[model samples]
Target: MPKLNLSQSPAVRAKWEENLKLDSQEKVTSSQQQLPNSAALTPQCIEKRWQVIAERTNKAALLDTDSEKQQNLYSSNIEHFIGTVKLPVGLAGPLLVNGAHAKGEYLVPLATTEAALVASYSRGAKLITEAGGVTALVINEGVTRTPVFEFANVTKAGEFVAWAVTEYEQFKQLAHSTTRYGKLKDININVEGNRVYLVFEYLTGDASGQNMVTFATNTIYQYIIQSCPVDIHSCYLDGNLSGDKKPNSHTMRSVRGKKVVADITIPAALIEKRLHTQVAKMVEFGQMTTTGSLLSGGIGVNAHYANALAALYIACGQDPACVAESSIGITRMEQNAQGDLYASVTLPNLMVGTVGGGTHLPSQKACLDILGLYGSGNARALAEVTAGLCLAGELSIVGAFCAGHFSRAHQRLARR
Candidate 1:
């Protein structure tokens, strides 16, 4: 098979070059006034930024009445501090989770404006609870940052890789020196022509660890530049190989933040009575969706993983952007010996944290408290609960589709 190359066409090339020229011109001519900038986490700085926004936009709605509390607590999490945006937090559970870390029923808080979302997840949660709950486990865990070093030629790259392998201990030491919670796990090296990418994987305790791994990688990079026997022409902190905040096949195969799997077996009688569909119909629908997923060239095969993850992450103060990679997973449905339905969801990159980021924020913290998953010892439990939540969402959505009520439910809830 031959790959289609659109850039090879003269017309396409000319259009692309023209677009680039216009973009460059726009960058030079744009007179967008920069907002007030500051590193200081004071109420004055926050007020200044908010004033500028209101003056320019002519909208003076206050974010909150208490500016001091916002400045004190939210400074570390955000910059250009202008109040906060609110989303409706909906409850979707009695989601019974039986897992290595997470146990018991949780009333999962989901923040979303999508009309039928909470209802769908709630319906699935109730069904799962009736079926004796879902089993969830955190199978693997790691956070990675890839640093690329460019040399003059392949030989120099090979020499750098050879020297780099021996410095794993020193690299570990330097990385560990930066953080008490993160530990250097392993370093994998990949060579491409004159460039070598050093993949540093770390075990970050209780946090998503994007910043943790970056700081650790920087420490290692600095040490390498000063101590390496081989010379490097150029280098970058991130080579875009770690699959951070992006959906890729690598994360689908291996783990990134936390790999969690959740499954449940529901009786056929319950499926028919509660879900308004038979086990056979659900399995058939699953097969059709799997084929459709393949045709679309999606990274993982699943139904609406993003819907659940996005809502949960937002409500819990996780980096919502992580959903790009975090939602990539495979969902399977099959029939057991008794013709009961067995459903499972495997999320290989569940980037989540129990502390840090937005977890400490008022509403987010309250949501975490609702699940009893706040503070340090609950990250893995949170991941397990998330997997179980996703399983509930998948079953609900698949059941809705199979029962031919998907559009009707959306119409009833979303439209009216």
Candidate 2:
């Protein structure tokens, strides 16, 4: 292939120079535009920022500032405050959950822009509710922070690991000193040649403990650096072993946050009536999809766990980014001896909380309030509910696929 020189042509060269000049002018104009630098949560600062945005974009008509109130309440959650972006929140359920912590029928609030999503989840919820609700269980709960310590050789790494094992009590005490809700559960040492990765697991009660564990681990890291007899060549707060905020095979096998499982037995008649499909067909669809998922080298096998999880996370004020890991789960559908549809979803990384993060924000709090899971003593319940929600999503999507209504439903609901 030969490279063409557009500069040789007068028309092309003139057009290129004009385009460059326009790009330069636009960059200069953009550089000159400035918003308020103050991080104050005051309405005055917010208004000034909005004014700058309006002047610069001339397209701020859609961004409403009229809804701005209680700006200080958002101080902890946001910086360089501006008005909120409103998403259409829909209600799904009468999702009856029969879990250890989360029990009874609850209305699930789903904040999303996707059409038919709430309806699909609600359809599954209704089926589950009629079938005596879903049985959800908090199998385990733990958040992790993996701090890597590098040494000169494998001998030094092994020695550091040996010494670190004795200091578990001290590390636990140091971690506890930082947060009332977070508890250091266990520490597993992973050695890779000359590096030692300290995987610190914690039970974070009622709040998603990313920042909590990070702070506690940093404290322990500093203490180790100062007091450890072993010489460390290098150190990092996170060694990516914990799989925070990313979908990986590690989180699929082990828990990164709360591990929750939800299952429901839908009668053959109920499956036919509600889902417009037979139990055998649903099972067959599940088998094919599971095989396809495995063939694709995916972390977890599921139809669309992210759909329900993203909506729930947004509505509940949980970190939306955690949905990456939280959505990785296994959805199984099999016909029981009684010919009923036995469906289960095991979510190993359902990173959620009923306190902290965006949970206290007005709309988020309101959503959590709707589920009656707005504060402490409700994190486990929240996780259970999340699993149930995902189960509902799985059933609905699978039913749609089996019934040959997936694209038709989307066309009717979304393509309009």
Query: Candidate 2, residue 379: CA error in Å?
Result: 1.0
lDDT value for candidate 1? 0.91
Q: Model 2 residue 397 lDDT?
A: 89
CA lDDT of each prediction against the hidden true structure: 0.91, 0.89
As a TM-score, model 1 comes out at 0.91
Question: Mind giving the per-residue lDDT tens digits that candidate 2 earns over 356-398?
Answer: 9999999999999999999989999999998998898899988
- The best candidate in terms of lDDT: 1
Model 2, residue 212: distance off in Å is 0.8
Q: Indicate the residue-level lDDT of 286 in model 2.
A: 84
TM-score (all chains, Cα) for each model: 0.91, 0.91
The residue pairs in collision within model 1 are none
